[model samples]
Target: MKALLLAGGLGTRLRPLTENLPKPMAPVGNRPWLEHLLLHLKREGIDEFVIAVKHYPEIIQNHLGDGSRFGVQIEYAIEQSLLGTAGAIKNAESLLSDRFLVVNADIIHEVSILPLVEYHIQHKGLVTIGLTEVEDPSHYGVVQQTDNGEIVRFVEKPKQDEAPSRRINAGIYVMEKEALQWIPKNKAVSIEKETFPLLIEKNVGVFGKIINGYWMDMGTNERYRKVHWDLLDRKCSFPLKEKEQGNGIWVGKDVQIGSGVLFLPPVLIGDQVHIGERSVIGPYAVIGDGCTIGKHVRCSETILWDDCKVHDSAQLSNCIFGYDLELGASHILYQAVMNRTAGVLQG
Candidate 1:
């Protein structure tokens, strides 16, 4: 089966980071967020992919190319005009001729898709959507299903009291090719608001499969930070190298460690990083590639992206520093904004 990846959104919520890089290109650990999604999907035996591109399309195209590196054939569908979720899929209809999977590029989940595909085939449903229960359902498109798993209602971001169920849409679906007929071409349409409801009204079969696993929507700074922490803490599963238990801090290849360093473990230092001595690092920290760390710095529960430079005596806690930014000496940052750029002396 093929897959349609929704990559056209502007990602306005993840500003500063999304100011330059597309949401899909934003680094989750050391790699782009979309990289993890693609790797996961590829492992599931779904190789052919069609990515809908809009904002910073070239960056994704350049990085992923033809998907040969991941053993998949990738095609690009550029959206000249803005298309909503359903419209985006319709725009790529020519390429997705058979049963296919649809996923929001910004969502990260460990749930398996194979079962959902099997269920769709067995029931001969037009669409099979993945659903998961969330504590607070105010912000999500909620789904209400029958006892036998057929969806009875589809509501998009309903008021708390108007919600029929706490089972929110997981933004993952296995769609039949014929579902595209319900969506008009060259027009903006939402599956939740427009297409899915129409199907339910016509007695079409739309099934929901509930899943239990690690899932996250990395659309905000806070959630983005938490996603990284989850990966580092092994709360979620991903293909990342594990560090061997040892004394002092372990640094990766091409790393530059400066003098007077006080290092602590469970910390991961990526390739080509520069660390200044007398600086206390880690306990729970992840420093990305090519970062420059200054002297006497104290950091915990912080992640610095590639090429970020933190000067001497700087103290950072529970913060995320984006790429190519510079932090001056003695600066203290606590729960502040430092989105993707550099040269800040204070938090």
Candidate 2:
């Protein structure tokens, strides 16, 4: 099935991180966050994709060119101006199939799409939104559905006391082409605020499919960090190449471990990493490719991006270092986040 992947959003919530890269491009588990979504969809047999992008469009185009690397055919639609969710899909209407899937690029989930498609077909609905139950529905689009699975209302970001349901929209949908005509041409529109409400008004069949599995929108640093820990904890599953060294510690090619170095489990170290003597890493650390760590350095619950260097005796905890960042000797960084673009947040 053809899937419209929304890849264009200025992730304001993920400041320093998104300051230079798109939200979908943020690094998670040693690869681009969006790669996880693409691979997940591909595993479900969705081969053709229409990626709608705006911010840093070329980065996405260059990285996933033709989608051949990931075993999928990809076509990109660049938005000249800021177009809301439904508007972006409407812009790519020509590339869409008679019936297709729409997914938000910033979300990570493992729910299968096949059943949702079957459900949509069975109900003869114009759209079938994937729904997931969450502990807190106040920050999401609360979905109210009938016992038969037909969506009766959508409340976007309602207050906790005002929420009608704990089930929220998971940002994955199956939409029939006939529904596209209802959306006006070349205009900014929100599917949640405009299209879906209009569909309800016209009595168009719109249903919700509740999916049970891991799902998260990594639009903030806290969420981003939580996802890594989640993957390590086996709360969510995604493919990675690093081999598990032992005790849940995964390492990549050409890694050098020095004497007296302590490795706590659930740590992932990428290729060509060098750790010096008496250094401590993990419990939940992710060290990226080409990193150089000095003697007596301590890292815990931290993420070091590619080629980062930590000087001797430096201590780090709950830190995130962007690509090529260098920590000075004996530096003590705690609850800090730094990016290559010179954005720094220190606790």
Task: Report backbone clashes per prediction.
Answer: 6, 0
lDDT, residue 255, model 1 = 73
**TM-score of each candidate?**
0.93, 0.96
Top candidate when judged by TM-score against the true structure: 2
Residues 147-199, model 2: lDDT tens digits:
99998998888898889899988899999999998998888999988999899
What does candidate 2 score on TM?
0.96
Model 2, which residues run further than 4 Å from truth?
343-347
**Model 1 misplaced stretches (Cα beyond 4 Å):** 156-162, 241-251, 340-347
Candidate 1: lDDT over CA atoms? 0.83
lDDT, each prediction? 0.83, 0.88
